[model samples]
Target: MIALVGLGLGYMTPTVVFDTFGIVSDTTGGAVPSAYVLALVVMALTATSYGKLVSVFPSAGSAYTYVREAMHPNLGFMVGWSSLLDYLLLPMVNALIVKLYVEQVFPTVPSWLVVVVYTVCTTTLVAITMRGTSRVNLVLLAAAITVMAVFVVIASYQLLQGEGAGTLVSTRAFAGPETTLPLVLTGATVVCFSFIGFDAVTMYAEEAKTPRTLPRAIMLTVLLGGGIFLVAAYVTQLRFPTNAPFGEFTDDPLPQIGHLVGGPLFQALLVGAAFVATVASGLASHASVARMLLVMGRNGALPGRGLRWINPRTHTPVVNIIIVGAVCLLAVDFSLELISACINFGALVAFTFVNASVIAHFAVRRRELRTAGEWVRNAIVPGVATLMTVLLWTQLHSDALIAGGVWAAIGLTYLLVYTRGLRRPMASLEE
Candidate 1:
């Protein structure tokens, strides 16, 4: 349940949905659930591609790992570069979520201070004492889910008693006024942030009892995650059809919704759950990315002993952990909106290549698509998934496109220089 639920709906979905509801509502003209529906469809299709790829390359299989073996190493480096951007920003996003929860309670604490404390705590813990927190994280997940269930039940009760949207059964949440394809797609882009970690289960391909089970886990995680996301979006949309009543809280409606629906006690519980979830997610994302940086440094992709500096006593990458903490300080000035967009931008870039890797590995290179089923699984599914991901790309905000583009350009330039203008290959290539 944890390889990844610990990161999936158990962590990101509630936070993203509670955070993005207002954004999606404004963007989709009050049809947040509609956007979620679109995003879920896209993610489900992409999950199939992930399932296909991880089955073949089941050892610690990631987009970078799969594309490297199937396509070209240079291309895989580019995919890894893009994915690294997303991985790096996710911890910061969790910090921002912490800031929101802290701000909700304190109402006067500086956002910068909250982020600093959070960053320092998580970074220091991972560097000094990175022990198993799976049980603790699971307890937190249960607490959060319980709180959410209470909130939804209260919202449903109010709906029956004729409040807000005032009805339990209606298509208003899914197809409200002025909801168009572009608007919904734009909303989907924002909500896709919730599903970012659904594929993360594949990273544990090596640890899974069986290789076949790992890919299925990826697909199942996406589907189950989507179910939770849609239910939350649907109910919350009905309870608060638009962001008008939210006013300043439109940027973050979690606390405000709690108070409005069930008062301060419920509000505190909701914000508390947000804090627990963020801390769990923050620690996990921070350590994971820091170790990723350490690996890159050791492999010559990063070209620095600083990131490679392991603590003698703790045996963790102290330098890289601190570096990630410093990056998390970016949350002081960043909004959840822009950070999430940039992360999604990197995800889409990696996802597109992952789908291509499927075709390049099985359909094109293997040339074994004699049967209709093989052709559909290896070629057509991934082909359509690639298109779906590209469509989501068109919906990304301008700032994200620019940010991701610049990062990709830097990676491409670095690859060219490191490979002697593509004549040589990336470092550590024994193959």
Candidate 2:
């Protein structure tokens, strides 16, 4: 979970978020950092609600069970659909990032080759996941932490040289620009995307050898991941204040930062380190997404019988793994920013529901007023975050929003078909 969060935050947060915000408002203005800080505050509030929910229901179906028990069956399915989209979109985003980097290092290589290589690498990781999620998670955790340590080391050295700590302390200067409220809100929405993957921890509840332990892990992952991103962003600005287009720096900022800290060897290490981080995150994503699909299948929301097929030798969800892999591969056809936006949309939708679920879950419990506290902590903050997310979605380029809307509409239609065409008949058979 920590590694996944780190990879998610480290790769997605500082760079992409900054670029999108800059492009939209055409501002390297004072609001970018403020927007990031706002996103953190909002995420902290919603994380508390999610932390509590995960504590209560440590099932593989994190939101699946939470929405069902807290709200209604239809709501749970809706959460499932949104989560599935997030999971499905993430690998594509990550793969596209890798492709961008590969192009930077070897500009001559065809982009399609990079996509194929990424798919192959991810598929091999999925095959390994067939053994056990624990094993895959362990490797991912190690890889993620190792890469993060390298970043910390590089950043630390730069700070010591009086180069990378100033930005964290000094705010940017802005004048003459019309700093509109809607623009700030829109930037905050984009910043929200950087913090999206922390919830990957919740998705592992079912397979988590011990469910009770997951809440802590999930919270720890968020706290740690968020810290890393905050530091990385601050340090990046201190070291490279130009706010360079992410497309230009797509190869690896760490290496450039590493060169500033040390030299060529250090830069190479950082690139290699980022690769490990990428793989760990990619593998964790594969495991979590496959399980969600498997759980949905088992519940008969999907064609349970076929979708639940596990590899006899490995005891893993083979069919679901392949299906997710294929979709991720298909997503590679789109640009990285598009994939990231879609994932952000899906995750924000899930976060909103989870937070609302917290309030609903706590409201009916008569035993303690603690439940009221949970309601405020879980529901209210996430509710605000949800609104911010919607604003961000609206602010997105129309074509991107249209694509996301179409994907969501299709999922809803699938749910309707499942209910009428699948579930009602299953109920009749039981009778």
Candidate 3:
């Protein structure tokens, strides 16, 4: 349950709910529902692959560990390096969402101030203890789920009363006159960002009471979270078919949707809930980033000893938490779209490798040891996931592709320099 909530709710922020509505509407010509359905299917396949890997190698390093054990250390380093783009930028994106939500409620508050407050608060909350962070996240997730449930009820009531599209049941959100296959695919690629944290459940495998249950938990997390995301997108599209009102709120649309359904008081409550959700997301992202850095530092893959230092009382990497907070301070200048694209790019790349890792581990190396069922579970399923993720990767925005490329190039450079032109290993093999 902890894995499910942490991975599912941690990524399904209110900002994601709104931003996806706008982005998918722009790309799919109002067929937001179909696009979300496509993304959900693709994510479900990817989640299946992650589950297989977790069952085989339940470790804290996530893709980094899976790829290294299955394939080679060099490729594993690249996968981990690519994942840094997602892990490092997620806290900033979450902080930006909080800033946007607060600014929406109190327009006079400066963006810089909001960013500072969010970063400081989130970093402090995360640096305290894992137990405390989990408690806070559970509370925030419950509140977010309640607010969304109310939203769905109110939106359904409004639709029944001849508002917006003037119909409670319509295919307009799933298919419009202008909707095309290419457009829906583009929207699906963008919507894939909302599913980023589903794989994060694997990071907690080492601590799980029964490692065998993690695979089922991963699938449930994706299914439950994806269902909520699809419903949110569907209802939001129904409420605002044209996507024009979203122009006023490029960062958030839930508050506006709340206003349309239940007036200003409800809108304020939704905004407050959204703020809490963003903070929860920031805490989760910050903790993941700190753990990744700590793992890499312990392996001597990172440069500094700072990331390796853990406080005895707290059992937390204080220096890495501080560093992540400092980086999040730069969130004030980044646009939501750019941040979304880059994050999706990095996550997609890492996911692609995870799929490949499964095939490499199960099919090629242990061909004689596996039954047909195991072969299908380990190879064929992940192969489909690889293909789907690669398709989405091709559909990423140009900015995202370029940014990811540059980040990858930098990682390659570090690997080459650190290993003296690829002649030596990147991390110690003793572990």
Candidate 4:
């Protein structure tokens, strides 16, 4: 359970407070805390669905397993394929974040070069082995948490001393002058990136000591991570209520915020922490995605021909690791906002299906909704979760929908060709 919580929180890419803080801050029009608050509500609710599903399934497939068993297999495949956008591009997101920070230090360096170097380093490390990664990530997560607390204290001191927003606690921190429901929802969609790891706890269900422990860990992870994001965002928002001073750095504002509150030394410290986060998440996600693709390949869902190539000495699926790195290179051309929205599309798709699967499994399959207690647990909870997920989906950028749609469509075409009209059964996701 402890490891699961750490995994989930670390999976959130804790550096987001620095990486996309400015993007979400600008997107919400200074209502950064409110965006986080709204995102927390949505994720906290969705975590329930994840907890419940993990108890029943108790396996590593996550949303793919739940939806495939409860709903139709093809629909499950769609959810899994859409999820690739979330899993595969996460390493890219980390790379993009590293590029943004690296450019600040070496302004003359081409962005593409930074991404390529970062990707190559991460892929090489993971392709060889992942020993001691958990310990490294834990240390990194601790460092990030320490940095966050320092920033909050420093920013709070600045605010109390009449630096930015005057007062430390004000409504302005949550709602800016131009803040509206639509804008806040849009920001909420972006901040959902911070909560991406909560459902990941389900991946460890089988390893959990008890069925209930995994669900508990899932909720605990969401709540704990959300608490950290909210506290930091609140203080940061209070320190700089608007992006007016952000000018050109509105997309990646950590540098500006760090310099303002803690000067060059603190700025360097924060950047270092952000770099640590990128390395941890990048290596972890790279290793995980390579294995996921290998699973899909072995199941014949995706191309299996070359994915089976394990290096003789490393004993790793070197080809799949390289494929993962190649995908991360796309980060060179994608902006932080567009990449974030696109990933959110895939995550919301999986969230949508996970909630829907609960209804199908209990209310539809088992007819357990007859009793009031059963109705509330099996129907109302997941029903509201599905609705909230759809609400967030409605706010996703059009480009994200198109990108995710194109990916999903490609998966559908491949599945149709491979399955030959759903007459054959593919391998179970549990494998």
Candidate 5:
């Protein structure tokens, strides 16, 4: 339950919820609500496939472990390598969004300073101990969910009172005059980033008390989180309406909406909640990326000993935490669009492989399941998810494709050199 809630709340960050309005609007010509709905459907299917994989493996490494066990170690290495872009850079992206929000409230402060302070603080919190970080995450998650609830109530009331759109019910948010299938798909691709953390639940299998129940937890997280996202997007879109371009308020739309519905005080409160939420998200991302690094290191897929080093006192991978922090410093130089695109690219690629891993595990390799339900769960469901993700992948920005391709090339090069042209097993480092 803790993992599910954390993954749900952390992935549904204020930046994602608010900023996505503009991103989808720009692409789909104001079909923000429809984009979110489509994205949710796709995510639900993908999450179902993820659940099947977790039931079989019940282990860490997420997509890496699933692919390695079901397919080949080399393919798993590629997945892990691609995943590095998602897990390692996600904290940096969160930190950057936090800095942007801070800049909105205090325009006089230097952005670079905000980035430095937030990066240091988040990294310190994560490096201390997993137990401490988890506790802090729960508190922050509660706060964020409360803030979102407040927004929904206030926004709905405002709409009922004929404030923004002067009507409670409208179809413009869902199917605007300019809406098209391609545009909605494009928006769906971008909105897919909002669901990135669902897979992180599988990475916690080793720590779960009842490992067999993880599949249920993964599906529940997606359903619960998707519900929150759909409501948030719908109400916010109604408050702003289809005619208003979210681009003008992209830097900080939630607070802008907060000010609109309540007042300056409410706006300030929402901003504070957003900061806390970003920190919570950064903490989770930091811990997850560190664990992935530790797993790879222990398996000899990475620089062993260094990343695998766990602090005896805190029982945390301190070295990997520090490395993540160092990588966050690069966030100061990149734009939010570039960072988000690259991260989304890697996550979608990894998700594609995970869906494929399910097929490899149940239908092709094991061939143990003979019933219709088993085939639907193990083959048909994942096949649909694979098609959806690949379609979404094609909709990604050119920059994302180029960056992901370069990263994949680097991983292939390493595999060739490390495995001696695939003659020996890729786990050569473990020996």
Candidate 6:
């Protein structure tokens, strides 16, 4: 549910939610589709390794569990810490997006009030998350899917009417910004966030009704989500003039697109969809991150013993969920610039560790494996993806790098204290 909220609607319809971040053909230099395709390819290789790991070790911690089993315990701890960095910081970006849309509807409202309101809404949702995951997520999913469908209808209808021809372009003519490689890489890093949620399915391995069926679901979701996003991006570009500043479209790109192609109703629906989409992301991020923390706690990586406490009534990790919620609310107070930068920094680190985990797993099993084709899935693909993530990290701001470094430092400090005090020998490989 949380992953669905985060990556489902707005990810594909980035034009509707975060148009300022440069994921569309017009703003990103006509290479939005290609960027997504590239992301898909990167994830596909990683996903193959992920599929094997998840099937063999279907646990709640997702990637961390895989890393712990396949590699050194300290490496697992690092990946778990990195996963927390990704989840905790991403809500800052989401909250900023929410604040922008809120300010759009009530332009006279103070920006601080918008931030406060967004923080409150996300926190309230987090509070409710401790109660149970079912009721709230069901409602959010319904609303998100409905809003997406409405936009699709409105956008498709407008296209049928032969309006906004200048804004839309043929796929053959698509050429993204012919800028310097660094600039393009920076933009591509931003674009990559849209494709991050397909892995969320692995996190829910424990709750899956049919665990074996999940690999197919993950693949299907990625393909379907990617395809829909491609169409949405093209249609959005066709409707809105490309030259508009990203800041102008940050609040409600769909309404602007609606105004250009259709009318007021479409605009209203688009705003509604954007809000629902943001809500979905917040919820999913909440759930997934909390689970990662719980897994970390269970293995003694984190200090709090109570982090593993599960609610008997709700069957949820109450303490972890509350902590994640509080952190996300804090993120709302931050500037969007910081939030976006933080997300890239955290995710890149986690992706790097995940690729390393895959490589280690394949190496350990190489002698046992008879198949000649295992190298690409286990070794070569993971290597390239890891390099790509590390390269992307180089393009991030120094502040983000510093912030991520600080976070890692803090985690390492905590781990060091725990290990020394307990005499656990954590840095050394554990049998």
Q: Pairing residues by index, what is the TM-score of model 6? A: 0.83
Candidate that would win on lDDT: 4
Model 5 TM-score, all chains together: 0.95
* lDDT string, candidate 6, 243-288, tens digits: 4634455433444554444466765666676666666666666666
Compose the digit string of candidate 2's lDDT tens values, residues 1-431. 44334433433333333224333223334345555666677677667667788787766676766777677777787777877777777666666766655665568998888777877777766755544544554555565556556666676666566763343355542211455666666556656666766676676555557666666666665566566555555545555544353335532344455455557676666555565555555666776778778777777766657677888877778778777777766744676556666776777677777777776776555322356665455555656755655555566545656776787788778777867743542211000
For model 1, the local distance difference test gives 0.80
lDDT of 2 at 81: 81
The residue-level lDDT of candidate 1 at 301 comes to 71
Off by over 4 Å in 5: 242-247, 428-431
Model 3 residue 333 CA deviation (Å) reads 0.5
Better candidate by lDDT, 3 or 6 = 3
lDDT over C-alpha atoms for residue 390 of model 5? 90
lDDT value for candidate 3? 0.81
TM-score: model 2 vs. ground truth: 0.81
lDDT of each: 0.80, 0.61, 0.81, 0.82, 0.81, 0.61
Candidate 5 deviation (Cα RMSD): 1.9
Query: Which regions of candidate 1 fall more than 4 Å away from where they truly are?
Result: 1-4, 10-13, 129-131, 306-315, 428-431
lDDT per residue for candidate 4 within 39-73, as digits (tens), equals: 89888888888888888888666787788778876
lDDT of 2: 0.61
Order of the predicted models by lDDT, top scorer first: 4, 3, 5, 1, 6, 2
Candidate 3, 98-196: lDDT as tens digits = 777767778899999989988898898888897688778778877887888888888888887887787767888888778999999898888887778
- CA error at residue 238 for candidate 3, angstroms: 1.5
* Candidate 6 residue runs with Cα over 4 Å from true position: 1-27, 110-139, 149-169, 177-182, 245-255, 366-369, 421-431
Prediction-by-prediction clash tally: 0, 2, 0, 0, 0, 11
Query: Per-residue lDDT tens digits of candidate 5, residues 252-291?
Result: 4655666767788988988888878888888888888988
Instruction: List where candidate 3 sits over 4 angstroms from the true fold.
Output: 368-371, 428-431
